[model samples]
Target chain A: MKAVLEIFQNVHMALYAIVFILSLIKYPVYKNTSLKFLPLIFLLTLVAESMGMFINKVYESPNSVIYNIYYFFYFTFFFYLFMKVINVKKYKNYIKIGIVIFWLFYLRDLFFTDIFNESFIESYIVGAGLLIYCIILYYISILQSSKVLVIKNDLLFWISVGLFLFYIGYLPIKIIRSWFYKENSFFWILLIIQFSLVIVMYLCFLTGFLWMKKKS
Target chain B: MDEKEIIIIAAIAIPISLVIIVIVLFSVFARRKNRMLQEQEEAKKVFDRELAESQIEIREETLRNISWELHDNIGQLMTLAKIQAQMAQEKPEMMTEVSETIGTGIDELRALSKLINPEALKSLSLKEAVSLEIERFNRLKFIEAKLTINGSVMPIEANTQIILFRILQEFFSNTIKHSKASTLKVVLNYSEEELSITAEDNGVGFDKSDDFLGIGLKNMKTRAQLINSTLRIDSEEGKGTALTLKYKFV
Candidate 1:
């Protein structure tokens, strides 16, 4: 069970690294502003994950604060990514407002409410907010577009799907982590599920980067 | 079930349900988008077919006009020139008159040649084409036809010009054949953004309500819509028929 968990974590981290490297190659060719930030975000995630893993190994304590800081970067990067891709002007403002609200609640929880706890409150808020943005992206793309002729080849479509699957699939688990993490079997099952979702999400991102050509 | 088990089951159930919902929504949107594309392609096909049909109709109409002009006007003029030539042999002084008569026939044939040349007609601007039609009317002594240009002329797209010409041809055909009009007037008004054409005839016009669908009005309206032009027809029992067409420059 420990081996399987370790393998899953390793694969998840490797996928993140691959996506980051792929973004670096794609950045120059595409010259897309949204893609320019992806590599930096991925690198930040890797560093944060490594720090959390090292802290846990040496001190034998859950590195909640490392992830708490990572979540802040996660929310910030995705917020910027969503703001760039969202087509409607009104929806862009809405996403900006939503991000502001999420940050306010996240900062309040981190500093004042639960300073030392691994509550996953910020994850829940960021997850729910990102889920809504992903759904809205899909909705607006479908509504405003005359033809989603090759949706699989569409970068925005794939990106939204990846974000939607990862956030929504993991949202319930994040919400109930406090209760569920105590059960060893359930905890492993949830981790496996989360890992699977992460793998699928990264595969989607990879496909978008490799196969989806710049729209002329 | 314990609270823990219930929580586990609910957690599994909710995400699965959400995944199902997302899949369903995506499929529905894909289907709708495909349907819309199909409808757009069908509409384009119909428009192309109609445009081709209108082109053929216009060519046939022009051919019929050329045949009529040759038989009625040119044939009679040539016969007169032949008679004059026979008399000019005896009276050398009349040779100049005979030559003048033949020259007139040649000029008429030359004018008719412009109508027969498909390439010339295709390259002809809307203003030039309309002016030629007016000139033909005057030359034939059919009616007191007059063409008035209001503003500086602008070039129109080729396809749009063809459609507009066909619509105007239909109107002129109706006016000459049905309406016992003595005078016909055409006004071409060019504005900054649009071109407006008004054709009016002093004819014995019918009731507008009754003759709304008379002749090729419906076809004209359809062609106008195809070119994104607005067409208006006004007539009463005794009032002359007036057709106003406004086409915006795109």
Candidate 2:
């Protein structure tokens, strides 16, 4: 059972790498749009994951610091990109406010939390909530635009879906993880679910790379 | 709650929420996609209906033209020939006059038949169709009309041709019946990317804000939009009316 779980985890990690490669392959297609630098983010994520893995498993050191920095850049770029893509003036302003709110959370982590040793849970939760709001705004903008009819071919639409699904599903698990980590069976189950979420998220990214096209 | 029970609830609840989220996302997009497709289907139906109506109107107008020609033009020629034949029975010199009149009538009949033939009409390109209309205007002395082709002719989509033909037909009809224009000009400039058409008439134009031509012009604009193009109309009182349409090659 442990071996099967390990395999699932490895497969999920491999999926991220495959999705990263696909992003590189398809980078030129979306290089002109706001996603011009999207491939770099995937590359950043892959590196972050690999480094975190090495630190935690090989060096037996905490990986939270790597992820803390990774999350900051990832969420910041997405917030900025989503703001660019959103069409409404009011919602764009709201996203600006959200960015300020996200900044406050980052400031809190920098000032109060032990970012090098522990997960930035407070800011992660706050940022994830803001990210969800940003995704909602993105959805609203998609509805307003003619892109609604042809979102299947939209690369950013798929990525947004992947992020929205992962954050939303992982929200409860992140909250409940510390309370239940002492229970081995529960931790294993959480690990499996988390691995599945990663696979699902990367699968969406792969689909976007394969099928994505500019608005016709 | 005890720790063990809370763990149990959290484990069960996490998967359930994920499943619910997936279901909601699935249903939302599916519903949106279905609605979009339905709108497309509806637009297609409306276009088909408009196309059918325009075709019927064109046929009716053609039949009206034929009736007028047969009664006023061809029928008169035949009567003149008959009168000349009776006089030729008296003088034999009138025989040539009767033959000439009969020949003119026969030529007119042939032209009308070509106009009436569905196959000929179906095979007519937009350029040819507009040229024929221009020729008819000049032949009937309705107005001094000319059609100029600038670039090499290109094949337009069949449905697009029909819709464009109807728009121009409406313009020509208005010029003849309402514009009281002395000169009507149509220019078709075809390029690799698009076909730019401008049809103008030097006539008593209307107010820019006039709703008198609103319904007709609105209908024309709607049809243009249906074909993913816009019909730009420029007119002024004591000036002329010019309609410009730029249709991209599909």
TM-score (chain B only), all candidates: 0.86, 0.89
**Residues A1-216 of candidate 1: C-alpha lDDT, one tens digit per residue:** 889879988898899889888878877755655656667877897788788888888988878777777787777767767777667787778778777877877877767655445655754566476656746664675557763666656665666677777777777777667554575555666677777888888888898888776665
Q: Rate the local accuracy (lDDT) of all candidates.
A: 0.79, 0.85
- Predicted structure with the largest lDDT when compared to the true one: 2
Writing each residue's lDDT as its tens digit, candidate 2 over B58-142 gives 8888888889878888999999999999999999988999999999999989998998899999999999889988887787778
Would you give me the overall lDDT of model 2?
A: 0.85
Show where candidate 2 strays beyond 4 Å: A1-11, A18-43, A76-127, A141-158, A172-196, A203-216, B1-14, B76-106, B148-154, B189-197, B204-222, B232-250
TM-score of chain A of 2: 0.95
- Clash pairs, candidate 1, are none
Question: What docking tier does model 2 reach?
Answer: acceptable
TM-score of each: 0.71, 0.76
After superposing candidate 1 on the true structure, give the runs of residues whose Cα lies further than 4 Å from its correct spot: A27-130, A133-137, A178-185, B1-3, B18-26, B71-91, B119-250
User: lDDT (0-100) at residue B249 of candidate 1?
Assistant: 90
TM-score of 1: 0.71
